[model samples]
Target: MTMSRRAFVKTSAAASLSVIAASAKAAAYPTRPITLIVPYGAGGPTDTIGRIIAEGLREALNGTIVVENVAGASGTIGVTKFYRSPNDGYTLCLGNWPTFVLNGAIFKAPYDVTKDFEPIGRVVTDPQIIISRPDLPANNLKELIAWFKSNGDKATQATGGTGSTSHVAGILFQHKTDTQFAFVPYRQGVGAAMVDLIAGRVDTMFSVAANAIPHLKSGAVKAYAVTAKERLGIMPDIPTVDEAGLPGFYTANWHALFAPKGTPKPILEALNAALVTALANPDIRKRMEDVGQTLPPKEQQTPQALTQLLKDDIATWWPVVKEAGIKNE
Candidate 1:
C-alpha cells in the first residue's frame, strides 16, 4: 500500500532526526561520568591497577571516572555485571586473565570473553613472584623446591581463589616441579592471602609482582624467584625462576580494558585513544615500572592486540586447566 504524503514526510523526518541524535551522542561521547568496574576487591593488585588506569582515563578524557569493585567468583561476577550493562560506553570493566580467560575455561561463565565485550586496550602485564613467609627455610627457588619436596603435602600454598591467577600459577608450578602443597584458598582477593603469608599463617604463594613487592621489601615475605624470563629492573637482585633452576617456568598476569559488546565504534576509538595517552604519560609509566608492571609495546596497546591476546590466552590455558582438572568451587 502507498503511504500518505504527510505520513511519509513525517517518517522520513523522524529517521533523519534519529541519525543526527546518534551522531551527536557519539561526538559528545562521555557527557557523564563513566563507571569502571574492577572485578576484584579493593586493596588487591587488580584493584590498584584499575584505580591507576581510571585516574589516567579521567585525566585523558577530561571526564569523571568512578571505579567500582564488584569482586567475587574469580572476577566473573563483576565482569558479568559489565557485560549486562547498556552498551552506551558509559560502563566498562577492568578485567584480567581470571575474569576474561580462566573463568571461561574452567567454569560455565554467563558471558563469553570474545563475544560479550569490546576490547579497549591492555594497560599492564606483571610477572608472578614466588614468595613465602620470611621464616620458611627457603632463600631461593631451588631451596624452595627442595623444601616443598621434603615437606610434601605439609607445606601450604595460598591462592586468591580456585580459578584465580594465583591458583593457575600454583598448579603450573606444582606440575613443573613435581611437588604438591596443601592448598589454602581465599575467595575474596589476594589481600587476605598476603596477610596470611606475612603473619606466617600460610607458607607460600605465587603472587603478582605488584602486590608482593612491598612485602618482599619490608622483610615480611621472602622472595624465592620471579616467574619471568629475566629479573625486573625494579628488583634486579631477585633471580628469575629459570635462573633459579626451574627451566621454562614463566607466567604473567595482565590487565586490560573493555566495554560491553555493541558499544559505538567512535566511542570505542575515543576510549582507546584516551588509554594510549594515559599509558604514555611519564608519571604513569614510571609508576607502573616501579611496581614491575610492563606496558605493552606501542603496537600491542591497541584494541585488536588485546582481542588477539584474549583469544591466545584462552587457547593456551584451556587445555592445561582441563587436563589438570581445575574447577571453580
Candidate 2:
C-alpha cells in the first residue's frame, strides 16, 4: 500500500491526536465515583477483600470507589452485572478462582469470563482448609481420608454452590483419595455452609483460612489440615497438605482486580498502576494479612501476570471439571 505525502502527513497527524487524547483521558480518569462489585454477600471473604481493595483504591486513585455486593448463582449474578457495565473504567469486578475460572467450566455463565474482562492485577492469596463437623471421628487428614473411603455413601460435603471453589475442591479431594461423598450445595455462600458443618448437618467443608480461622479458634469445627505448602501463621497448629499426608493436593482462593472488556489501554494501565501502588502500602498489606490473606510478590502484581494466570487456570481446570462431570445444572 503506497501513500502520497499528503495522505501520510494526515495519517500521522491523526495518530498523534489519538495518542494525546488517550493520555488526557487517562489523566482525567475516575471523574466520577467508581463501582467495585463484590460477587458474593457482605461479610464473606470476597466482600472483606473487596472492601479493603476499594479503600486502597480510593486512596491510590484519589477518587471515590464504592463497593457493591451482588450475591447468588455462585457469584454469576454480580459478575453478570459487571459484564454488562460500561467499559469506561467506572465499574470493576473483584474476581477470584471460582467466579472467573471455575464457574465458566461448571455453569452456563451469561458472560465469557475468559474474553469479557481486562485484568488489572493479582492481589491476594487465602489458603483453604479441610474442616469437618465437630463430631467427625477423624482427627487428621489421613484418618479423614480413611473414614471417607469407608463411609462415602453417608458422608456429605458442604460447598458454597455447585461451581464454587469448595465444591470443586471437594471433587478433587475425592479423586485424590478415591472416595465419594454427596455434596450439599448452599446457594448463598460458604458462610451458610459453614453453619451446617458447625451444626453437624454436613460432614466436611473446604473453607478459606479467613473464614475458618474464627471457627477453628472457637472450636466450632474440627480442623484437619491446611491446603497449602506452608502452614498459616494464625493457625500454627494446623499442618500443610504435604505434612498431613496428602502430597501435591494444594488449593488456594486467590483474588485479582478486573475491569469490563474493551476498556481503553490507558485506563487499564492507570488501574493497574493504582492497584500496584495500593498493594505496596503497609496498612493495606497488614489489613489483608490479618484476615489470613497473603499478597503476591511485586513482580506478579501487574496486568500481564494476572492475564497469564487466568489463561493458565482456564486451560488447566476446564478439562478436569468436564472429565469429572461437574456442572451446576
Candidate 3:
C-alpha cells in the first residue's frame, strides 16, 4: 500500500529534523585546540593584537588557542594557509589592515577577501603616524607638503612595504599635496626604516602609532601629523593631518578576525562572543590603548558589520589603488 500525501509530508519533516539535530551535534566546537593564524611575525602590531585576543579566547572558551605565525610575502603566505585549511571552525585568522586591504588590491590572490573567508569581528584600530626625522624644518602637514615640493625627489619617504597601509597613506598624501617624493619600501618592518629616517637616509615616513610613539616621546623623531581625524588622547598636542592641512585625509588601520569559509554558524557565533568578551574587558581596553590602539565598539564586533566593512573598503580602495597604479611587487 502506498503512503498517503500527509504521511509522506510527516516523514520528510522528521528526516529534516534529524539532519538538523545531527548537524548541531557535529558542530560541537572547540572540542580541541583552535588555531589562530597571525600572518605577520611574532612582535608586529597584528601579531601582538592576535596574541592578546588569543589569550582572552583561552579564558572564555576554556580551550587552548594557539597563535601560529606565518610571515612571508607581506602576510599573504599565512592568509593562504587559512584559506586552504578545513573550515571546521578550528582555524581562524587575524586579518589586519593596510596589508589585508591594500594587498588585496595590489595582487591577484588565491582567495578573495570577500568570497574566501568569514569575518568573525574587528578587534581594534590605530592611526597612522606622519613622523619625520628631527632635522626636517616642517612641523606640520602644510609645511611638510611645501618642503616636499621644494625638495622633490631629493627627499625620500619610507614605508614598511610597497602596498602597506602606511605606503598607501603616503601615496594619498602625495596626491593631495601635488608633489613628488621618492618612496622607499622596506622588506623589514617600518621600525627598521625609522633608523634610516633618523640617520637622514629618508626624510620621513608614515608609521603606526605604536612604532612611532616611542620615537616621538624620546624626541628621536618628530610627529608632523597624525592621520586620525581627531588628535589621539595619547598625544593630543599633535594635530591631525587634516587639521594641519588637506581636509578629509583621515586614515587608520584595523585588525579583524576571520574564520575559514564554511565554519558552522554555531561555532562562528561562539567565537564572536569570545571576541566581544575579550575586547570589552576594561583591562584589555587599557592594554590596547597603551599601545596606541583603540578597541572597536561592541556593535562593530559582528560578522555582518565586518562583511559590510570589507565591501565598503573594497569600494573605497579600488579607485585609489587604480589611480595610484599599484600592482604586485
Give per-residue lDDT, candidate 3, residue 168.
85
Worst 10 residues of 3 by lDDT: 21-30
Task: State candidate 3's TM-score.
Answer: 0.88
* Cα lDDT listed for each candidate: 0.89, 0.90, 0.82
Residue lDDT tens for model 1, 6-124: 99999999998977887788788789999999988888899888888888999999999999998877787888899889999999999898888888877787787768899999999
TM-score of each: 0.94, 0.93, 0.88
> Over all chains combined, what TM-score does candidate 2 have?
0.93
| Per-prediction backbone clash count | 0, 0, 0
Name the regions of candidate 1 deviating beyond 4 angstroms: 1-19
Mark the regions of model 2 whose C-alpha exceeds 4 Å error after superposition: 1-15
Which portions of model 3 miss their true places by more than 4 Å?
A: 1-28, 198-200
lDDT of 2 by residue, 1-329 (tens): 89999999999999999889988999999799999999888867888889998889999999999999898999999999999999989999999999999899877877888888999999899989999999999999999999998998899999888889999899999888899899988877887888888999999999998778788889999999889989898788999999999998989889999999889899999999899999999999988887789999999998889989999999999998999899777
Model 3 residue 76 lDDT?
Answer: 79
lDDT of 2: 0.90
- Clashing residue pairs in candidate 2 are none
lDDT of 3 by residue, 1-329 (tens): 99999999999999989769746754565789999998866656676677888888888778899999887666778889989999888888999776567788887779887788889899888988888889999867788889999999598898767687778888888888898988887665575677898888888988887777777888888887888788888888888877887777788888899988877777788889899988887777777887789787889999899888888988988788988987766
